[model samples]
Target chain A: MADFATIGQQFVQFYYNTFDVDRKNLAGLYRDNSMLTFESAAVAGTAGIIEKLVSLPFQKVEHRVDTLDAQPSSEAGGILVLVTGALKVDEEQKPMSYTQVFQLNPDGAGSYYIFNDIFKIIYSAA
Target chain B: MADFATIGQQFVQFYYNTFDVDRKNLAGLYRDNSMLTFESAAVAGTAGIIEKLVSLPFQKVEHRVDTLDAQPSSEAGGILVLVTGALKVDEEQKPMSYTQVFQLNPDGAGSYYIFNDIFKIIYSAA
Candidate 1:
């Protein structure tokens, strides 16, 4: 059995680190079949996902994760991770609330690749 | 092949409708192996999930979905559905933003059940 808690923690750390520093390097974490839903747009495949991430409006961004939850999703050892966090973009004074989910599939080896990712920025209800 | 978009739309509609009207009836959509992460708390199994949900602070709530995204997650025909919406609890004047992810596993009988669910309420960053 896999230690999903540790895996989820490590993945969250690595993902935010890479996303904040070098987003292009995050491509290796995805495969050709991967899909990313950013806000209302859905992008498919590694190239598209990376392109979308790299093309975000902000030049600099940081993610501060508040909660992380993981669950074994499939009989094939897929992991579902949910994260609620705050994101600071550019020179923004206050961080924006965001929620993201990642579906990770074991690559038959000791590693895993992202199968699906969805991210959304939560606007204030007021 | 499963029509993930249609399935996601129908599932979201049914889920929120059941949740707003009679949350106890939503138990049929989950199984023993199901897990739900509400905010920072993790609840497992149908009974626990229902208890946690029914015990929420609000007397009445309504969800208005803003975006819905779905991706085929596994070879086993699981679907990953992500929803960004707003929730009005009781007599609150402003609806709070919320994001929820649901992993639906296809049962052998042409139906699907919730394998994992995570919900979060987004607070104002300002």
Candidate 2:
């Protein structure tokens, strides 16, 4: 059995660090079958997801995670993680609220890859 | 193969309707293994989830969904649904922004049950 809490925490830290510093490197965390639903748009595959992420309007952003919850999703070592956070972008005075969910599937190499990702910016700064 | 898009839409409608009209009935949609993360608190199983939901601060509430996205999650016919919407509670003039994710797993009876549910109120009325 895997310590899902630790894994979830580690993944969250790694993901936000990579996203804020070097977003392109985050592509390696996904697989060909991975899907990302960004707001209203759905992008499939790692290439498309990465492209969509790298093309976001802001050049500088920071994520402050407020809560993280994880659960076992499958008998095959899959994990489901849900996160709520605030995002500060482009020298904005007020941080926007956001929610993200991730489904991680075991890759048979004692590792996991992002199988499904959903992200939404719930509240925008006035 | 199940029509995931239609299933997702129907589930969203049924869920909100039941939540608004008769929240206690929502317990039937979850199983013993089901888990719900509401904001920073995590509740497991049907009893805990229902208790938490029914004890919420407000009595009269309505949900206005802005976007709903669904994707296939498992080889056994699980669906991952992400929803972003505004919630109006009580008589507040301003609606609060919210995000919810539901992982519906096949119940082996030609139906699906919520295996994982995460809900967060991203923005509160000012």
Candidate 3:
């Protein structure tokens, strides 16, 4: 049921939804084994990923994903999207720049998985 | 003529091929405007890509792409591969660890273009 066009829209919402923490909504987007390998941390499963979002110290975190190209292999039951964008992290004063890649499993429901995701974060000097 | 399986195989060969500079061979992989948005460098076109490869200061650099899942949309003429791996860089003494995502163009002849590529570079403690 999930096609690349549908998958692409979800991706945009997924990244931009960080504008405000929607725990319940966000949780629905991932699979049980939705591994999140961040630049500084790698967390496995939905529980682990939940912990990171709940424990983040930042007052505000903004992630913008632009220039997206997605490929959803209906036969393979998975999808991949490449996003050229930036992430603005506050409180810790991190660089808000990045080019990101997200791999998703658009499965029937919650069992979907994120096999891999790669992002380049750029930081500014004080 | 290129399928996901074929594209996947080429992906591995492409990354590993970087171990040694193969400009002519590498040149055949991308489209005319194959934009490369590296962690630190952004090069566009075959000429630009070639120029970057020809001017690297490092004596040795290694890129390892593992755990690949590729989707080639024969209907779309584009293939996207999600790779979980690391990059080892020398001379600059930086972190070689990373999880990368590559968007490739497996077009006819040399007509393919990379829409986007994102990589995370992990640096070691000094």
Candidate 4:
């Protein structure tokens, strides 16, 4: 399993890679059974998740990890990491900021999937 | 230190009490120096956080915990719990559901401050 810090860094990279449609790297960050719930709608399984990840139209996605907090799960050996940070999207080369939250399980030899992936746009009003 | 499950449950309870302006119970959940970062606005210290919490005019605040994921923090003794859940707020008796994320350190002795508290409102369209 990767350490918390290593896993945390990977998450930020994963966010950018996914948003920018970096299909090769995106495949490594998530598991085959990973799922995503956007707001209230559920998108189950990794394939569905990848479908959504590659669909974002942002020209560039930059993620800054402010903090990566982790704890033990109810299951004896499981882990739950909450990644909180700011994201800047380059839409037509214009920078737009946003807040993102990601929960991941980084244990043993596998990095596994994202338990949660949520973001809200934060940008200066035109 | 409270176990992961116990700490996880308190996280949900903390959300309701804090948002409902239940300042009394709120005192127990967070640390004395707990700070809150709202969207992108910085609200420093527990006092500042309370001011923001009590200022909300929702008729009632109800919070729920769907899944509590925990992992080990960088600190040897510190455990970081990332709580992922759904919340229903009774604003004028109209149910409003939203997604909430709370990162906390529930190790021992005292339940420290929230590492992260961010939520987005979700409602059905007319």
Best by lDDT: 1
lDDT of each: 0.89, 0.87, 0.56, 0.51
lDDT of 2 by residue, A1-126 (tens): 458777888888999999999798999899999989998689999999999999999999899988788888888888888888888888886877788899998888888899989998775322
In each prediction, how many residue pairs overlap at the backbone (N, C-alpha, C within less than 3 A)? 0, 0, 3, 12
Candidate 1, B44-117: lDDT as tens digits? 99999999999999889999998888988888888899888899999997888888899998877889999999
lDDT for each residue of candidate 1 in A1-126, tens digit (9 for 90 to 100):
558777878888999999999899999999999999998698999999999999999989989998788888887887899888898999997899888999888888898999989988877765
Question: Which lDDT value does model 2 have at B20?
Answer: 91
TM-score of each: 0.93, 0.90, 0.50, 0.48
Which residue runs does candidate 2 get wrong by more than 4 Å?
A124-126, B124-126
The CAPRI quality class of candidate 1 comes to medium
Q: Kindly report which residue stretches of model 1 are placed more than 4 angstroms away from their true locations once superposed.
A: none
Q: For residues B1-126, what per-residue lDDT tens digits would candidate 4 score against the true structure?
A: 566546666666665667566644565555654545443344655667667766665555666554444433333333344334444456444443343455565436565556445444432211
Docking verdict class for candidate 4 = incorrect
Instruction: Write the residue-wise lDDT of candidate 4 on A1-126 in tens digits.
Output: 566546556666666666555544565656654545443344656777777766766546666555454433323233344444455566544443333455565445654556545444432211
Candidate achieving higher DockQ, 2 or 4: 2
Which wins on DockQ, candidate 3 or candidate 4?
3
Candidate 3, DockQ to 2 decimals? 0.11
- Total clashing pairs in model 3: 3
Model 2 chain A scores worst on lDDT over the 10 consecutive residues at: A117-126
User: Sort by DockQ, best first: what order?
Assistant: 1, 2, 3, 4
- Fraction of native contacts, model 2: 0.51
Candidate 3 Cα errors over 4 Å, as ranges: A23-25, A91-95, A109-115, A123-126, B1-20, B24-100, B103-126
lDDT of 2 at B82: 88
Candidate 4 residue B68 Cα shift, in angstroms, is 3.3
Per-model TM-score of chain B = 0.96, 0.95, 0.68, 0.65
